[model samples]
Structure formats: C-alpha cells, structure tokens
Target: EDVHIRREVNALYVYAFCLPSCREYLSGSKGEGFLFPWSDLDIMVSKLPPEEISMESFHNDCAYIATTNGCKPGFCKLIQSYAKCDYYSRVEFLQLKQHAGFNVNFDQTIRGPCYSTNFPDGFDCCYALPVHPDSSNVFLRTFKTKFWNGVKLEIMNKNITVMHCVPKGPEKGDDDGHQWLISFSILEQNIVHSLNHVQF
Candidate 1:
C-alpha cells in the first residue's frame, strides 16, 4: 500500500509543482490507490503555446478557460517574457511574487549563461516567466496525457527549457509584465541562434 502511494506522488510531481515531503496522499484521493497507471517519461518545458504564439493572447486563453479539453484546471503554469530586444536581450520580466501568489522556482536561473547579443534568427530558447495564479497576463504549459484515459500512448518527451525574453515588438518594460516569453526544449537546433556579438 505504501509503495503504491509513493509512485503516485512521484508521477504527479513530474507533472505538477509539489514537495515530496509536504504532499500527503489519502486512500483514494491524492494519498493512496492508483490514480492511473505507470508511465516513465520526463519532460521539463519552459511553458509555452503551439510555437509562433505571443504572450498577450496567451493569458487571455488561460484566464478565459479554466481547463483544456484534457487538462486539470490548476495544474498548469505559464512561462512568458516581455522583452523588446531579441529573446532574452534585457527585456521586461514578470514578477512571480505578484502572480503565483506564493513563489515558485525553476530548475535553473533564467539568466547568466552568456548568450550572444546579436542573436541569429532561430536558435534562441524561448525566454520564460514563472507560472502565476492570476491566470492574467501569463505564460503556460499543459499535460495532454492521463494514465487512465484514452489509448495509443506515446510518452517520453522532452522540450527546450525556455531561457530568455525574446520580443519582436514594443517594450512594455518591467512594470507592465515580463509574461511575454515562453519556451520548449532545444531538441533540435531549430529555435533561435546567437548572432556572434557575444563571441568567445
């Protein structure tokens, strides 16, 4: 019984923001029993839309709908940025403190990795903001698969860990919101690239 519950917590952790120690599982709820099956896939995305999507309307979609056709209402988080430069080039940022209500963290800090200033057209990781609770002016991600539902399973996916704020439009600066950035995995060299200005 104990072993079964452990697996549930770990699986949910992969999809949601949770603390192993803090989460308490119940008999049939979040505590015990198999909410679904066992699938081994780990994907950490920077939260985003279907690519080529912008930040402005992204928040509207989330705020407008409580859930997608196949997603939990509160499990997803948005990651976006409001930079005017070219993706992570010193742009406005979101205040996670104001949105998430509490506070959340990423696997790594979004800045400091020394990317080029004159970025290439593609090859840039989508800059990301933290998942905020307001669902207003935010970036986001959603889980499409549930263990117990549907069929034709294809797990094991990875996404570009969106890194910086890349904006192709006006600069709203900090106060307005840095929720314009979103990112996925860099599986291929097809996202954004550096322009050679920050050469080594």
Candidate 2:
C-alpha cells in the first residue's frame, strides 16, 4: 500500500510540471496508481493538428480517412486523404519522431503503436491522435448502454476532453503503416479513479 501511495504521489508530481497546453498523458498501471516490482510505465502523447473523422474530404495535409478496410475488429486504416507532407508522410515515422523527445533509450522493436524502452525502467510511449466522444458514433452508443447508466452523468460531467487512436497496423494486414487502434485510456482511467477501495 505504501508503494502504491508513493507511485501515485510521484505521478501527481510529474503531472504538475506538465504545461497546461501539453497533450501528454500517463496511463496503464502507473496512471491507475498501481505499482508492483514488475510495473511498466505507459505514456500516451497526442499529435498536433488533430485529425477529423470525415468520410467526404480532407481539409489539410494532416487529414486522414479512417477506414476498416483489410483490418480486424476494432482496428482501422488511416488512409491519407490529401497530399502527404514530408514530415507526416507515414505514421511510423511520425510516431518515432514524436517519441524521440524522450530521454530514455528505446528498443528497436515497435510494439503496436508504442515504442518500447528498457532504459532506467520499462516504458511504452505511444503517439496518437485525439478524437472527441461526441464525434464518434461508437462512443455515443456505448454511453447509452445499460452498463453505463450508473455512472453516465458523472462521466459526462468529467473534464475528459478526448480519447486516442494509436498509429498501429492490424495483425494480418499488408498496409501496416496506415493502421490505427482505437484507445480508451482516458475513459478507463476515469473509471478506475471513480472506484472505491473495495471495488478497485
């Protein structure tokens, strides 16, 4: 219990230093304040020029059309809708560039959407695009379900702004570079935070 408290305090301390405008988030076990000897940190970093979920047009170079073509359930391919810029040509390169600012020594392997690092401690840093729940039909349907009725109002009233979609390819798809996985890290964190000690 002492370790858990320490970890929570440390997380809060680190969060305090983040600029209000920054879109970085600490997630997984670390964000939930559960630390064991084997705990690994999970960090989600939101990308700039947020991509819109549009099927008709691409407003800018950063815009992409999220399609489920050639992907498994819960995965989608972010097909570039406009002419690609040199900097944001590929998802892999963009994610790598985003994670390069971290001080840790990362492993060569890319695990899903995150870059894994073993230096100092194990870390999985994922670069993602933020999407609002209001804009997503799936999210809207989910919130209306009976399971969410108990805490629906509380969740809606929370300060949560966005959920993330990580840049990762489907397991069996040839277009591995354009695949993205929808992530509910922020919502999961909120649920965990709302739990009582016994429920947790």
Candidate 3:
C-alpha cells in the first residue's frame, strides 16, 4: 500500500510541474487508490483553444532555417502555413524539467480519446490532442505553440492537439464514410468536474 501511494504521489507531482496551466485531478481506480499494477493512470487535463496558446521567439526565419536545415535542435518547424505559432519537437520532458531546474526521474503516459467519423476540409475541429515526444527516445517531450498579445509567444509542448485525420478501417483506407471523428475529452472533463464533491 505504501509503495503504491508513493508511486502515485510521485507521478502526480511530476505531472503537475510538467503542465502547470493544466488542471490535474483523480478520476479512475488509481485516483481512488484501490488497485495495484493498474493498466493506466487517468489524469484529466483542461484543453485550451488555439487562440489561448502561442509560441515564443519564433518567426518565418526560424521556419525557413528549420526547413532548410531539416528541423535541427534549438530550432522549430511551421506545421501550419497560417498558424500563429511554431511547433517544437525533439525536446523531452526531462529536458524541460532541467530547463525548469528540477532533478527528478519519473515517467508516465497520459492519453485521450480518438474515434472515427466524416471530416470536411477547411473546417476547424478544435480538439486538443496529446503530443508525444519523439518516439526514438522514451524521455523525449512534445509542445504546443501559442501567441500572446500577437507577440511574446508562449510555447507549451506537453498537451496540445492538432486538426488532422487518418485512414480508417482494417485496410487503412479513407473514403469519407464515417472514417473520422473529433475528440471530445475536453467537453467530457467539463461535464465530470461539474459534479459536486460528494457526487464526484
């Protein structure tokens, strides 16, 4: 029991520091502290719209360099042509912790919902997705870019989503017959949190 609590508490703190602006709450069996060797730890993060996020110290020159030089370290890539922010990958959670000046070793994976439906082009789905670090390294991190005041960009790589779709079905095909869906975990979180403490 002590070991389980210790592990959970440690993970919770790491998550808190990793995503300061995100809301952290308990929602599953682990949150209730009733099981050992759990399959997954449920952590709910508040999803913010693209308007609320921005990338700092990024510009066209940065993207040009990244594109020309192939997105090297200390550089960024422009995933969207008209996006107000720049996307930064190849950095890991440990690197961010170091940037924040902390010495701790804990690894956890927080996930969200993905589904299938029909998607239309030029439409803004507005869903927040978990951006995983480069898969090459287990400790690599991901960030979401946002701009503040049309300047002073803030780059947060931990939890951000993009608007994209994938091939659905077994053969991996796309035909627009209910093969895509927009994520709604953020709405679900709002609904769940609305419950009173006793009900929660």
Candidate 4:
C-alpha cells in the first residue's frame, strides 16, 4: 500500500515539474498506483494551440464544437464551425507536434487514440481538448445521476472542470476520426485516491 501511494505521488511530481501548463495527466494502471511488470505509462495531453480558444471562449474558426447528434453515449463528434486552417483537423499532425520533444520513436502503427512507443518501458500518449461541463446540457444531464448522491459537492466542483474530449478509438466506426470520447480521468483519479487500502 505504501508503494502504491508512493508511485502515485512520484508520477504527480514528475508531471507537475516536467510538463507544460497544458494539463497533462498520468492515467491507466500507473496513475492508479498498481504498476505490474508489464504495465506501461498512459498520458493524456489536454492542450490547444496558442491560436485556439476553449469552448467557453469566443467561437472562432478554430473552435471545435462537441455535438452528440449521432454518437454513442459518452461520445460526441467534434464539428468545427468553420475550417480556416487544417491545424486541428489533422489529428496526427497535432499529436506528432505535441510529442516532438520527447525524442522517442513512436511505433508506426496507430493504437486507438494514442501514439505508442515500441520499447518495453514505452508509453502511450494521447491528445485531448478541454470542455466545460456547464457549457452543454448533455454533460449536465449525465452528471445528475443517482451515483453522485452521497458524493460531496466540493469534490464534484473541483473535478468536473477536468473533463476532456479525446479522439475516438479505433474500435469505433471509420467516421470516428471526427469523433471524441468524453473522458473523466481527473474524477476517476480522485475516486481512486479516496479508496481505502482494502478497497484499493
């Protein structure tokens, strides 16, 4: 249990110091503090280009609007109101630029929404964009479930802002390239941290 907690703390420290202010997160087994011999790192990067603005900000040609019109539950299609440029449209380009400084050779094959490395101690990196839950009624409805009954209001307020829209995984349809999965990584991390030793 001590080792588990230590691992989580170490990951947070590394990310807080080494990463930029783009809200990069350590996720998967390592972030949950259950590292096994085969465990690999999972990183989620939620940063927009310098020219872009968040959904709550001004809606310009660079803005991506999340719409659930034809997607499955917990997923939405990112529709750009106007295409002034292909910067955000080309997901691969954005991902490559984001990890350029890592100096690691990523595997040629794309794995779901991540760009993975082939080494034994490799990591899976994914790019995402932030979306405020209060910006859409769909998100508000999803959060008003019976599951949140006993949860503290403060925790909800703190974690909900961390919600993100990740690129759709390969398991979905071809049109998935334009789709985004709603992620609650921060909320999940908090819940894991709150678990008792036995529960963990």
Candidate 5:
C-alpha cells in the first residue's frame, strides 16, 4: 500500500502538454485539412537517445563542444540532457504511451464527424494525442480541438463514453443517418483539497 501511494504521488509530478506554436486560428479558415500550427509539449523523466546510449560518450561529446570557449561542465550537461532526455523522451515515449500522431483535420463542414477521415485535397492536419504516463490511472485526456462554432472538442481514447450518452447501437458501425450528434457528460462536483486528521 505504501509503495502504491508513493508511485501515485510521483506520477502526479510528471507534466504533459500540447502547446500551440502559433496564435493563428485555422478552424474557420479556408484551409482544407490543416487544423492549426502547434507544438506538442510532453515532459517525462526518462532515458537518453540511442545515439547517446552510453553515458560516457554523451558527456565526452558535449563536454568537448562546450570546452571550445571556456565552457563549464554544467552547460555541457544541459545540452546533453536536452537532446538525450527531453527530445528523445517526448518523441519515443509518446509512440509507446499514446497513439501515433495523426494526420487529420476537424473541419466539420468537409469531413463531418468521422475523425479517421482522410485529408481532403492536398491540405493536411497535424494531431498530437497524449496518453497518460501511468496506465493504471483511469483518467484519459481526449483530443484537444478548437471549433469555429464555439464548440470545443475533447476526445477520449478510451471506449468509455465521457459524453453523456452514445447513440443506439453505437458499436455495430451504424451511422443512424444523422451526420452530427453530440453527447456531453456533466460531472456534478469537482474538488481538490487536502485531508487532515489525527490518528495513531
């Protein structure tokens, strides 16, 4: 029990994000498939890049580059860690942790509700789907979408419907002849706080 609680606390510190690269909005634009320009941010404490697999080689290479103009050991460590830890973890970990980055656009006008729909014409969209670092946690963050119609979209990777209610026979691949149907689940109470009590 102690081990489980410790692990949960550690996992809470790990941060993940999908920050937009540009402020420009692509939802209502004339673009066909490109959703928006954004850079996904996912932070995790993990291993180094394969190229820098050995700890010795990484420090040696980075140290040599840094030494050119009176560089310090800490500077070398920063560069080495950034490439080895930051870059590699974000790209590789996501591949294993979440679904592959998708090429899609949420243009409801052209593509309708089918997220798997292909890119129309030559235009393309970039999707950054993040999976929880801790698989044991039942919480999953759906896709982050910004719509032109003021309706934001968050898609859950899990089959469990966070949305209020799924349509009749949603599993058997039935369209129900309706192009658009939206479901929303409302949580009654959301609170975060500390529990303090005297025992023992």
Candidate 6:
C-alpha cells in the first residue's frame, strides 16, 4: 500500500509539473495516514499560474494534455459503470479496472474520480488521472467480460484493495434534496495537510 502511495505521489508530482498553473500535494485519509487497505489516493491541486510567459516550450504542455485525453473508450465505460455502483460495493468490474490502472475514487455518490474543471457556481475543482504508457493493456479487455447480477464469477484480484468513506448525511443534500452533495475529500485533505504538526 505504501509503495502504491509513493508511486501515486510521484505520478501526481510529474503531472503537476506539466501544468505550470497547477500546484498539488497529497491529501485524503491516505494522505493523513488514516487509510485502511481500501482507500482512494487523493492529491489536491491548486491552480496558480506564474506571472511570466514563455512561448518556447508551450507545445509540450499541449501535447501532454492531448495524450492524457486520448485514453481508450473502455476506460471511460469502466469508470462510468463502476461509478454508478454502490460507492463501497466490491463490484468485480471495479477490481478489473483497478488492475487496468483506473483509480477507483469518488465525487459525492458519483463513485469515480473528478476530472472536470468547468463546474457551476461555488464549485470548482479538477483532477486528472495520470497514465503510464508502459502499463499493461487491461482497460480495453475489461469491456469483453460481462458482470452478473452486480457480481463477477471470475477470481478476484487479491492485490486490489477497497477503501471506504463515511456515509453522506442529510446536510450534504443537493438543491433538490435528492442527491448527495459533491465530495470535498480533496479540500479536506488540504486542510489536514496544512495543520500544525504538534497541535493537530
């Protein structure tokens, strides 16, 4: 688990360097060392663009963004499908996607990672999953298998861990009071990391 966290930390740092406007730090229960075997890796990124402008290396950032967006379609379906499942439910489909390098996370009850920058008023947060070119091609193949009654018959991956979060309360309800509020896990992480060491 520590190894995975280190890898995730390095990945986020590398990706953050690609985006000059962004500064990120580890955040979440895992960031706070309060995670169990099953916890999502969280990294909080704040946008802080530098004042100076340089035209010489602008294409690299553009290319990096393009590559990140050009992920396989199965990856999208896997996230969407898993997200729709119970946030803590051990859907076998999730295990497969995790092996495929998809980070199983949550944004409210969405059951997946938050990757959008354009949000409505009073809500603005964005995160991008870092991809490795050398990782095995597990994403495309996950589409071939079908889940049965919210379960899979195949053998589960033992290496895969499950992280659970506290249940959403009534105060977290949306404007319609039907949906749970969006996750502030990232924000919470920032708060956790910024605390005074001895006092906290």
Give all candidates' CA lDDT scores: 0.28, 0.59, 0.30, 0.60, 0.23, 0.31
lDDT of 3: 0.30
List where candidate 1 sits over 4 angstroms from the true fold.
1-10, 15-60, 63-182, 186-200
lDDT (tens digit, per residue) of candidate 5 on 5-30: 53344334322221232111122112
lDDT of 3 by residue, 1-200 (tens): 45356546855774666554443444355554445563345544433223121222223322211221332232223233254454322222223433442222122211112111222211111122222212111211232213122111211233223221111112233222222222233323334433444554
Flag the better candidate by lDDT, 1 or 5: 1
Pairs in steric clash, model 5: 21-38, 142-155, 164-184
**Model 6 per-residue lDDT tens digits across residues 121-187:** 1122233322211111232225343322212122122211111111122333222212111233442
* Comparison by TM-score, 1 against 3, better one: 3
User: Mind giving the per-residue lDDT tens digits that candidate 1 earns over 39-136?
Assistant: 22222223343222333234432311121222233222123334223222223332331233223322222322112122222111223332223332
Which residue pairs does candidate 2 place in steric collision? none
Q: What is candidate 5's local distance difference test score? A: 0.23
Minimum summed lDDT over a 10-residue window in model 6 is located at: 159-168
Q: Please give the distance, in angstroms, between residue 135's alpha carbon in candidate 6 and its true position after superposition.
A: 42
Q: What does the lDDT come to for candidate 4?
A: 0.60
Return the TM-score for candidate 1, rounded to 2 decimals.
0.21
Task: Tell me each candidate's TM-score.
Answer: 0.21, 0.69, 0.26, 0.69, 0.16, 0.25
Backbone collision count in every prediction? Answer: 31, 0, 14, 0, 3, 3
lDDT of 2 by residue, 14-39 (tens): 56865543466777766666666788
| Model 6: colliding residue pairs | 38-162, 38-163, 39-163
Give residue 53's lDDT in candidate 2 (0 to 100).
41
